[model samples]
Target: MSPEPLQTGRRRRFQEWPNYRWAVLGLTMAGIASTSFPITVLSASLPVIADDLQTSESAVSWVQTAPLIAMAVGTPIAGKFGDLYGHRRLYLWGYALATGFTVLTGLSWNVGALVAMRTLGSFIGAATLPASMAIIMTVFARRERALALGYWSAVTALSPAIGVAFGGFMVDAFGWRTIFFIQAVPSLIALLAAIPLLPDTARKPEVRFDVAGAVSLGLAVTGLLMAINRGPEWGWGHPLVVAGLAVSPVALVVFAAVERQTADPLFPLEFLARRGFVIPNLVTFLGHMAYMGTLVVAPFMLERSFGITEVSRISAALIARPVGFSVGAWYAGRVESRLGGRAIMIVGALTMSVALAATGASILAGWLAGVIALLFVAGVGQGAIRTPAVAGVANSVDDADLGVATGSLQMIGHIGAATGITIMITVLGPSESSERFFAIFLLAAAIASASAFSARWSPGLGTARSAGAGRRSRW
Candidate 1:
């Protein structure tokens, strides 16, 4: 379907600014934390979970793979659902489903049960990632959207950093299942918040659910995730891997066509094709690719090269990440009110490059402090780029398709981070040595800087100076 126009003017009925902003933003963070918590939680819990299930580490590793596979497939579909339905309602349901599965996950008796339950659970839970953004865009004005996106981005990104530092202790103290239990906090909190806090505003639904598009895209993403996830273990050239790799590309092409032709496609082709919407997604995808390198490999390097068992606590250095992200977001958010998304994105991209290179230098030197400081810088850049990036898309497009746009944004994240991590691991040699990782950071840094250049030519998404400000919004 065509892009829906955003609701203009002041908030109607009970959906006031400042009030709805905090609550919705809080819930967005909570939803993202709960949905994606297990990815890192399971990593921490692997020792206990493997022992309890009498499984090999290699066999149980699918816990991470399965969820990504599900989420990769589910994200866009869920995004479309949010657009078709109400994002607020869908957010609540996503939380509710996540809460139920999390509880069931803690009760599983064996690895098989655990894997199966989690597979189903991820499909339901991870939908919140995209849905939350859709709801936020639906509620906020164009000028306010960037800062809102900025704050939301900071909180969501901070979750894994928090998970890394704390997940280990939580597992050691409360057992691995506590990870699942802890996830319930967000679900319960968001569910409660939605009752009184979620704005009851609704869009005049326009996009029709494309069943064929759903199946094709779902199959393609699931197949691609499986191929990439298993490629590390199974060998990318394995017959099944070859088949998955071959199928996904074809399906992806078909999925693109479906969007282009369908009268009311599940995903709008214009947003994906447009510069404002597409450029930031591309740069952010690269940024996430760089982040994937840090997120997955940093601790491994520390553990192997430095022999640090208390790496979890050391990982707390990443707290600096949220610090940078928040600062970057606030600054860029303020600028997005007046300047434009393109300019802010360029700064964020530049920050990303510097941070990634510094990260490499620190890795080579084996200094944890340097690494942490670099991460903080990278995060700030990430924060600056994302707020305007998303606001660019949200402001450019009509509101009816806001859910689709937001979901597409997040889906790019999942697809890029998922594939990028796999690719980085493949290239980094798995040795955890500074030399082995040096290339990783260098390459990531290069990508960041290059993406910055690309952002300049990207299409404009348009921007609001600020809802409260008395100026024109830029794109």
Candidate 2:
């Protein structure tokens, strides 16, 4: 169905609920899928990439890690960039560069070359995602925001899902090279789609890049992100790696202090103060961390433990998310308007925790059906939290600041995912079993449950009248 068009005072996309909003959303969805697809597509092809390029698993892992780290570094900054420069140019360049890099990765002759190529895509992928959220939130209004966000979130979720399935197909058919080659098509499509649809929003001329603030965050984020990504290979004890870990906390402390003092903070203090904002973001961090931590292990459980082929396992695991995410998000918007954003988020978080716990327990008990069911349940939580979270922030902030706020949330989410993966590798030992894995799943469940409850903290529902005032003091 065509989505309601953007509210441009013109009969845009068929008098739909979110008319032109739908067109923008379509680009956002496509962009997200493309960001995730490149990485997931390469995952099934990791073995293939390693063999042909004479590389190790660690090297191939960079194809995924580089982009994630780049995203982590770029998301918040890019959000502000979107706010200042406009989402259109950044989104276009991001997708265009991503398509270029995908091509580069495809033709790479060695692991080093592939990583370098992936880095370029990673940098571009970095720009696309958070900006997509910022652009959507800024354009949509309070009432319809959540639902629009929900569907947008679904598309983002689906990208990884589709990539996982598509990756498996390409691997099973031609070879791993098809993963990169196929990704080029969607990236190009997104770039083309964004051109006519994405709105033109300009930045304030006085708004300058916080170079000092940027450096502080860059140093801290790079240190932390590098440590997290490398934990699997570095044994968490290497001196350089240890420094990266040890310095991150201190650096962040310093960064926070600096942000608080700077005339114009890189991340505004008021933005973080809203209870709804803070809690939802925290919840997002935990959810991403837990799910990402487990994701690396799930393919193995599907293929090795359950005796499924790579393709079926990929499709089953992935396809469920897009379906659930899209449906749940669309519904949540309706639910949020009637019940409140807080309620919807709480429900999502709780459902996620319970589902993960169930999935783990069922795996322990030899119940394949249970695993499938729980995965879908986790999607329920995802659908619930994501759309509402974005919409709530949009409602809470004035139109002008929406892009920055969206960027803030996304950056936090990326950090959480990175940190979770780090924890997973750190916890690794020889005694992995369904039972042990169940324990880990329960831990993941706890994170999900926490996410559900965190909704109460957002200022989205509060009566703070100041456009974006007083919020700076609270966080």
Candidate 3:
């Protein structure tokens, strides 16, 4: 079927049901929450899993590492696939695959099996994000996109928080395996709901998949992520680290060359060169780097500097960040039409920078309430920036390129997060000193400040609004 007809059918359905967009958003959120549940749960259950499987902590950690690598490698390719085939089709398949793998993970007898299953699940689950974003952007008008994306961001922030809060209890009560089993229930529900709720995009049968480009790009991303993830564990000079560092650049070069030569490129280099597209992604990259980097060090800083030893209290403090995030996201969405994405992003980034700086001062002053307050403020900034950044990227691209554009944005954001965490680890360096914690926050502040500059170039000023109108006319 032609895309026009498929889209017409979807539009008619929506016209028939005024509230169908809400149903789409709800289903998408369910898929996202279910897929992300295991991330935090597995982290909390790592020690128990290691004891049960008779493995070391470092070895068990691969359960997390493998999935991170897989998701990073697969995300862009999955997005392109959605563009070629159909977002709805890819999303449904992703949920099915994730559900199956979740069950298999529950049944795993050893760490190796668990890692393999979880990695496969995450690889497939990565497809849902770009597909969901594309759907939401398509269904909502440009003016309302930021508001919709705000809800998406809130769910993204909340899922892990919910998982972290209840994960340890579940692990202790039942077992690590039971968590996977429980996760499968929600995934299955999402899969079934998606069947009727989600609409398919028009497939491009004539567009060829860039198999060689996918392979090379996957290898490049995997190598880089592996180097960052394992570099600290294995000395930076280790043969594996050296090889990964060397291979990634070579593979990236090969991928770039392949993209230039291919008739139908996986990532259109021309689209990447657009100021609107590139700048929003760069802002997202830097913003996430600062957010995740600070997050990595905050718990330890709380324990050492403020003498908060209880896990519950520390969790409560951490919860403040996400709450602030939810509030900021919703507020940004409500006000984006008046403020503009660029202005909103600049304000958000500066807010985060100020919060991070305040956090450092609070730690030095040994003020616990001040630390929590600062983190909450930082979360608000993080939440506010995400919606506009995402909407800006979505609006900058054509409808067909929406999947790949959003997917690449997410891929870069994840890479930034990995880089941020790695830098924080390197700075902290086997020490629990106040000075190192202060240094980490200061570095995060610098990164956040840089994001404000990046936001200045964001296409959000006028380009996105006009582009969105053009896209709507076509639909």
Candidate 4:
């Protein structure tokens, strides 16, 4: 063979630049963590916010609800749009909007304005979620995909912890609004960093935007989430709850019909129908349900069953979960290439199942140490499952569909978390008994076990295929 051309060698070396991918990942992680600050801070500062605005707690709660609904609706739309347009452009726009909105949120004069501004900001910021993932998938080859996802998972799992700690300090020092100001700083930094570091994906100009499908899907998701969130407060049988439940299904049906008629559907039914795509997402939903349900129920169980009333102690015990999550996520990424995504997910799910079961046993036996340890194990399992599951879903889809596919998976997972919390709360009921706590944990365990079984059907179950080759596999 003739000697390799010098220009070709230089091009190959440039393509293999190690710092570029890491820089992209770092910027995206900062953006993700910064955006999440509002959620945790808002939850912590609710009492202060309500008092400052001279509003009832219920009314002030809308600040959180508005963003939650906006995120759920906006995520898929952003993902699909990014797929059609360019993800880099959408990402930059998202950060700019987020930074501006955070500043506006800090300056809000009333509850209603705060809610509206936060909702708009979150809706725009939601674009960054899918766009960042799409960029990571495009830049990193298959061998490194799981590791990149692992770091992504770790940052996500760790962000709430960081937010809570810093938010509490800011709320105490400068008041609730200061947290928003703090949030804006990082977002501005991420936006500036992304401008120069992020790579642009080729735009599919031929793909038509499905306005009807987007609207229908957004309405459907909003209705369903609203019903779930308000069911306990309004009573599941309340007229509004019943109406919301009814509307969601009707909207979903309309969305399906609209998608069928669209030239470039927001959600491709054929893609969703595939076993590779569907099964991993199913596992994700089940796993998050179990994880979130247990997390919400644990503090109550600790206070009532173990009588651990100290806020610091409770916080310390809860903190272990995220710690475990960070460790497990990092480790999963390191080993995924060797063990494969399916195996890692299966193991992760089973670990969570065991942790849930142990939690139940610990509560029943009145073992505080056991409860804390089990909580950590559950967190680890949750983290492990997430990294592989996300990577698996990304690997299963074509390059064009990466954004929407990942967005849909995250949407399903959030729905699962909401559903899980609702169901667990119902199980706890108007009681403070160990028996009820045990029941909740056992139910979570069952859900976790089911998630493990579902992992069996993930694409490339035992194979060690590279990213490029994985994309060519049968649906």
Candidate 5:
């Protein structure tokens, strides 16, 4: 017999292996993290970047903020496109384009150039979220989705913490440009692996793409996110912010009208009515407001309230929450079968809320240990809810619309994060008073508590029920 037949047989068996999905998960995550980790790494070294480029820290912040805003606006559209085309194609294409932009980001000569490159990279890279989620969901069995999503959530949660943990050191040792340059290598490797390893998803070529709906919805998200993002910076009364606020509702109304009239809508209007779908998104929105709000404030609190000046100590403290989040998400993914989604989410939210409230007290009392511990607990709480919530949303939607559903969820979460960051900063203002820190954290706690309360409305489907739903929804 020829060796060619033997080689073909081995390749077929490898593809048929059940654990191949894990390979898919690992590679795609590497691609996603490669593009994303740089932004967070840059966050820690904004002062360095600003100084290098002859600009202010505030001006350099656009390197982070603009990319976030771009991702918020672009993700859903990219997801819808992925569904119309194929997720595997989009994942590879998006990452490949993003890798090129990552290199450009490293080579940027000025702040404006860096911001533009990063924003464009993130905007195109946004496709990876829905595409990766859809791919993983397709590969994993229904009962296994929670665990898969849990690991996915853990990576997403931990990457930023890891970036912040090492970002400052890397910037000081190697300079900021080298970071982006190095990031591109992993992305390129992932793109290569994906060419053969990732499974091709079924595409819906017959369905007419919803151009009008996509445009109007994109406009609406852009307007609303821009308003929230810029309102604090430019002042709420700034004409551009006001215009953004004004445009959002009108664009939303137009989007609703377009979605209704379109033959193939970008998003299914009926999913809005699903308790499983809506509640997780609502909880995510509120939870992130607290989670990210605390993240933005902790460094400042350490300096102002705790009087801690060491960057290493501050970085160590800042890493606690996301590290906690990574652990909680990992644990939740494993036990979702026994504890159920609703219970886990409620517990997570309540835990976060209580921890955040305690954090405020810790800061006021200047107990650095307590503050670090509380932040870690807050992170765990947020992480615990994320995997179950994402898995729940995936189970509720049809297999074909998984990308759109997950994309929309991601977009909402990003919007919530931006809003939370903005609100915390606004409330904290320039005052170094511990009382101001306390007030802002309490506000965050209240918001988190509201999220906990909202979780009760979510579907209580455990792994079994979710599995049943997944079977019924499969394309």
Candidate 6:
């Protein structure tokens, strides 16, 4: 390239800036928070929205359900595209389209419109999950990525909690639609800034886009997630639910076949064979099962066992988990350099298991304080695993594959959380008794313990970083 073109490119990318990486991380997070907060914030206003739209709460609940299913199906595809095109390109397009949908969401006239807008917004916005991680991994050195990812994990854990707490207040004061309108402003700003400041990741244009694999995998995941999500409401015997359940495994088998034949697979089937790649994802899946299961049931436990029905008080009690999560992520990020990723993951998962088991005991004894404190510890445990787990998986893959790799990991985690929530709710099953709650929690605890044991096999990022210093570290 000529000198003038080089100068313009540098100006556009701002790579010359000493702290450009941090700037990218901040702007990326700002954009993410704008979109993500609404996911949990809407939960606080579901009843209000149902009444205003003249719809049943059951009908309006699709606002939450739809986005989740869309995200689960879209995450891997978005990541794959980023690997084939460019992370910055995917990020820019995704945020721009998502922002447009957010505006539409604010203007929704009915529950269906609201659900449609949020679902489309999240479907496109899912690109940001892997794109952001790829960008960070691209910008930072191997040894430095853990800390950057720690902050990322912290924000991911805290954004929803903040949404539920402060967002509820905002909804009461300004109305639900206003929240989306406010969200759009920051998202737009972030998009504008990202255009100039963010750098792109490597693209594999030589490799063919795996349309067949993407389609098969999308069908497989969508069917499974839809079945799991609706089985409780529609009944497992419902034809649609049974069809979803039946179609999913068949689709997955087809997906595996498609991936084997595809020259460039959407998610490389070979990665599944690697202990480093597979075990960390399994740990993530198991950990989320326990954490999310407990989270879904905690409010009910409080309401039934302690008569703690006040929204403000319940919100206050629940905030501890995310707060502790933030702390644990920060601490783990800092210490992963010394203690190593696998060890941190093991300890974190163990803490979650222990905290949850104790939480069950606390509930049985009517110790509300103990229950709240244990929940915080559980959050910390979950948070501690986030950075290391992600780092482990990211390092295991080639740089070209980071987006899909991390996206797959995230997808598994989301599925685990959904499965956990479903299982816990099923076990609790209209029962208000403390013993029933305790027993269900024990199951969650057992699930988390399984995760802890699984963590023992996680790839060691700390060791990999230490062993390889000058070149890109692949664990």
lDDT per residue (tens digit) for residues 316-417 in model 3 = 678778778877887887788777888999999999999998898888887888989989999999888888888887877787888888899888988898
Best by TM-score: 6
Report the C-alpha lDDT of model 2 over 58-174, residue by residue, as the tens digit.
768887777677767777777777777677667777777778888988898888888888876776667776677767765665556666676777666666666665577777798
- When 2 and 3 are scored with lDDT, the better candidate is 3
Candidate 6 contains a number of clashing pairs equal to: 0
Worst ten in a row by lDDT for model 4: 1-10
Model 2 stretches with alpha carbons more than 4 Å out: 1-18, 303-323, 459-475
lDDT of 3: 0.83
lDDT by residue (tens digit), candidate 4, 1-475: 2111134444345446768788778878888988875565567578789999999999887887778778888988899888999898888888787789989999999999999998999899889899999999888876788899899889888887777666676677889888888888888887776665677786899878999999899989988988987798679999878888999999999999998888789998886656667777899899988998888777788899998886446666787788788878988988998888888889999999999998998899999999989898999998998888778777777878888988888788878887888889888877888988988999999999999999887764313464533344455
**Greater-lDDT candidate between 3 and 6:** 6
Query: Would you list the C-alpha lDDT of every candidate in the order shown?
Result: 0.73, 0.70, 0.83, 0.83, 0.85, 0.84
Clashes of 4: 0
Off by over 4 Å in 4: 1-17, 309-312, 461-463, 466-475
Error of 6 at 195 (Å): 1.0
What is the per-residue lDDT of model 6 for residues 192-235, given as tens digits with 9 covering 90 to 100?
Answer: 77776788678888888888888888888888888888898889
**lDDT score, candidate 3, position 378:** 97
Task: List residue ranges in candidate 1 displaced over 4 A.
Answer: 1-13, 16-18, 34-39, 164-166, 201-207, 317-323, 430-433, 459-462, 465-475
TM-score of 4: 0.92
Scored by Cα lDDT, where does model 5 land?
A: 0.85
Worst 10-residue lDDT window for candidate 2 reads 462-471
Error of 6 at 203 (Å): 1.3
lDDT of model 4 at position 333: 89
